[model samples]
Target: MAVLTSWVWLLAGCLSAAVAEDSNVSALYPPLWEESPEQISDYRLEDGKHIMDPWVITDRMGMYRILLKQTAPYFASYAPENEQNILWGLPLQFGWQYTTGRLADPTGMTDCGYEAGDTLCVSVDSWWADVNYYLSVLPFLAAVDSGILGIPSDQISILPPLKDQMMFCYTVSGCQSAFPEAMGRWSAFFQYMQSPSSDFDGLLEYLWAAHTSSLEYPTRAFVDRYAYYSDQEANFEKNWAIAVDYIAATRLPTTLSRVHSFQNGLPPRVLVDTDIAPYIADFTPLQNKVLVLLNVLGNIHHFTGSLFLTAWESAMSTKAARKLFLISFEKFLETSS
Candidate 1:
């Protein structure tokens, strides 16, 4: 009986030790299962619907926050001063040092919020670093496309016009080049809607035209290279249809008519004070639909970037080319917003 009692005490002590160890681990790497009140307050999620900013919203969602925290220890383990260097800044600087045979200080490279000691700022800085790096690579990509990578002019013909298409797709002012027919149709529809004699039948016709142009047969020619990802392609079509339906079902014409009326004679201050809020409220659903469509389009952009990277990798077969492709892909993911 005494021996049994000893065994029981030993087991309990072991369990206590294990629990204490787990508590330490939890302190070292906190899980983000529940957001703290401070985080909620800082991010302004008290109302549940209003987001203070993109970063705050992303933080509230715990998007990459826990991952950054959990990985902090590993990052700190290798830094010279045990600095919080979360973005592999130490290693990157060391790599540059080794390559150039000179000690490189990455302090300036760290952005406003990140200074190698703040874990959260490190993660955010790393993200923006990648964004800036990718943006900076666009000119290099353009140069490569113009024959810097040594691809014969003849071989260039086989490559898709990825850069051109990307620019056309992203540039709001250049939309006419990408979808001339749709732009022309929408222009005529808007002109008619703005006229004094505009009626319900004309609105219905405009809706039909928008549906046909935007949904039934979109500007596929611009994105023809992406036929490989059939699933994404299908989603693109479906999301676009939803967007068109949302627009058609909304009080878009009425809102536009009000705008035209305001433009014609209404006092600007009166229009701003009275009409703007209702116009925005009326288009809120359409705005939500646009946000959804933007997400879908972002996915499409990622896939297209992957396709372009693959093509570039295949054609150039060089380390520089691979790096360029990676940069281009990162740019696509960042800018697709």
Candidate 2:
């Protein structure tokens, strides 16, 4: 009986040891694996430059610099005719032809599909493309600011306002309440542009017309008419003051000081005295870059006005457009000097 009890105790000890071993194995191979070997291998390859020799890295960078230098002029031109063929030219041509009744009717109709005719179609497409081009360059400009050119990302908050304004213009439902479902916001914009006056006053006039034509009639008309002449005037003045304050805050001179400080921190081997001094001089690299960005923005703004006039006739939202206009004008004043 004593011998049997000893064997039972020994068996119990073995069972406990087996359970402990299983728990230890499970702890080592937990269910939540941190990363797969494949993911780790890919990360290492990208982060370590594929473990290439230093000479190979240098050679690749040098080749890239050479390519960028070679292509600089093409990009720098006011309008590269060669690139025009690829970017705006073909798209514009196709858009113009399709909308102008020169091509077969897109809807398979025998007659010109639109009562307003080819002009309206052309106008819509042109406006769409102009907006597209303006928005597309923004990312590239942001990349230049942060990556290659070394301008701090925080300094250039201008892009977001402009983007928001463009989006509001494209998608806002305020105009939809006036125009028919078929007409859409584009028609409202087109009508505004077609008006002889295309400024704030012009916008007021367009709003009045929309108000009168709307099914809501007297209520919408009365409200908008009074608001346009009175509230809008006060709003405009207030916005102008705010924009002036922003300009005072973000003006390029302040930014130049920041850029200078950043440049000062670089090792002597990486940058020379000549490079540093010239960057602060009249028409500095910083200035040149800002000028390029501003110039593009200004040109697009002006081009949009032109397209609006061509398509229907002119525009800006209250806050975004006003701020952009003030900033661009201020930069232009500095550039003129």
Candidate 3:
């Protein structure tokens, strides 16, 4: 039920990097996260005019401005050798985002254990959500294009999240260790689905060169990969149908429509923005937001089924058929390490 607006971002330091930041791309990051004008006077002039040195960022009410004004960006600048970005008690809180009407307001879903603003986790059934994942990846890709990730455009896949190949079910920690069993199975399944061949070498090159990225820096990889797969208008619907049938007949529940709204859900993929100017050339804000929202919901449905399969603890045998519930979730490590 949440909407994702544009997510591109840039990385310039405090007041010092103003010229370098502005001279580069304007489309990659949100206004608050990018370089900006020095709005106030830094000195007095002999000609009766005041000299101005504007602030570098625009998030006057958000963390960028407020935090930088009070302190420097890096902990290295701290007077005490061991200090971090904590004012009062919050240590580097990203600007406010609460699930209720306001950014930090409580949702009162403690009974359901659903906290607003805490990332929503859903288990999806038979649905296609690459579109959603692509939306999440765009911002990171933008950063990469902007030269922030320090990799040649061709070498970006050497980046963390995509380097080791596998079927990643969700963003729990780093994908492989987080859901080893599920990723193991999904990786095998995707291989079976694609059967990488000489004919599909284009896809392989795209994946190795572009589709993959480090979760630590997945933004650029996502933008290119998403555009590649979805834009090609590949046979995604047919493949998803096959996934639905496999789940329905041999897996849990009867069909892919059985979605889980609570307890588990799809998560957004994170990325960095290094390259963004060219993308802004083709940017269409209204359409992009709508696409991201649709992807988020669809991913939720698909992930729920995967969670149920991984969470299936025991075998079932009964005169009236069988059922498996997460009877003792404590048996498994519930939190992502």
38 in model 3: Cα distance from truth in Å? 20
lDDT of each: 0.30, 0.27, 0.24
Query: Which residue runs does candidate 3 get wrong by more than 4 Å?
Result: 1-24, 35-175, 180-337
How far does residue 236 in candidate 2 sit from its true spot (Å)? 37
TM-score of each: 0.22, 0.15, 0.18
Model 2, backbone clash pairs (residues 3+ apart or across chains), number? 6
267-287 in candidate 3: lDDT tens per residue?
111111321312322334322
Q: Candidate 3, 255: how far from true, in Å?
A: 37
Using TM-score as the measure, the top candidate is 1
Top-lDDT structure, candidate number = 1
List model 2 lDDT by residue over 217-245, tens digit each. Answer: 22222232222122322232222222222
**In model 2, what is the error at residue 198, expressed in angstroms?**
48
Residue 309, model 2: Cα distance from true site in angstroms: 34
Cα lDDT tens digits for candidate 1, 1-337? 3532332232122111111112222233222324522222233333243222212222322322322333334334333322232222212221222232111112344332332433223222221222222111221122223332333322211111213334322222243465555545545544554456765445445534643453322333323322322343334333433333322332122221122221121111101122232243433433333334334434543666545324322443444543343344334334433
- How does residue 18 of candidate 2 score in lDDT? 13
Q: TM-score of predicted model 1?
A: 0.22
